[model samples]
Target: MTLKGQHLELLPVDSPEYKKHINKFKDLHLINLYKIHYTGADKNNNSDDSWSDPIYFHGTGHCGCIDRHIERRTGSVRISVSEWCQHDDGCETRGILLQGHCREHSLHEGRHYFSEDIEVALKYAADGLQEHVASDNLSNKARFSLFLCKARNIHLGHEAMHRYVVSDYDIIPCYLVIVCRQL
Candidate 1:
């Protein structure tokens, strides 16, 4: 299945093409993008060494978040928005990823705005996965995993920034995910 005039195909897992696509996604932008890897279980049979990539999503900029995990003995990847800014202090201008609302130049009176159209983001992510996977014959598990990864990546990539806020209405707690496709 194809959409938006782009032909998509799911390259083999861990293939050179797959690695290239992932790397390209990572290098797209420096803002709000985060990469996480789960090493393995600990002595207590619990996960360990799981941490967020140092790269933070800059407000209003496109970024990618990648995560790997195991559940029920199945491997999974998740990509999504990391976080959005609640303040406006030229932070968005500098493309630096940080937390907290800027009190001085409060865009929403120093309040963070949540996303309003998560479903749209989700669809976009699904489409992306479809393109990448490029095969209608993919297993449900593979498709589901791809959906999760794409959704997370889009969510994190399109997270709002202080600069994107043009009106007071843009500020809300709706949990908006980023969409890199737009970038």
Candidate 2:
């Protein structure tokens, strides 16, 4: 799906930015490195100040396959409410989550969640891959295409122990790093 209301600048592989930032992740094939341009409301104007220090990693449940990732289509690079919670009361909870009103629960306080550990983020991506692959019955060729795409596509972070819970206003997806796990 085409990204609406967002502009992603794909970085070249030989670029200094890609080499310095993306080359650290070993065993993961680079698919794309996009500098995210968020069009969402910046209540504190932190996007400009914090764009260079995007040391945090957000697990988007994407297995590095661009074709299957839905969150990338949004300007905020965030999943919609319906795509977030699948419970029976999701319709009602959607509003609360969207408004950043989920302060009742400690874990659900923020609208977005991120991790500092790349491995943890990768685990989420792998888990998502399982779910995605299981839901569909694709042929071997299709599965190969997913990995092959990772092999191609030339384009192409910091220290924190805790998970980051960002509010809707302060949340801005600074970059999009797409990497496929080497099997």
| TM per prediction | 0.22, 0.52
Q: Which lDDT tens digits does candidate 2 get at residues 1-183?
A: 111223445566676767876754666666656554334334435435444253655444322235444234323344433343444332222222233222232233433344555666665445444544664543222211111000111111125432443333333444556665642
Q: What is the lDDT of residue 134 in candidate 1?
A: 54
lDDT of 1 at 146: 17
Model 1, position 102, has a per-residue lDDT of 28
Model 1 has an lDDT value of 0.26
Among the numbered candidates, top lDDT falls to: 2
| Runs of candidate 1 exceeding 4 Å displacement | 1-32, 35-96, 119-179
| lDDT minimum window of 10 residues, candidate 1 | 1-10
CA lDDT scores, all candidates in order? 0.26, 0.41
| Winner by TM-score | 2
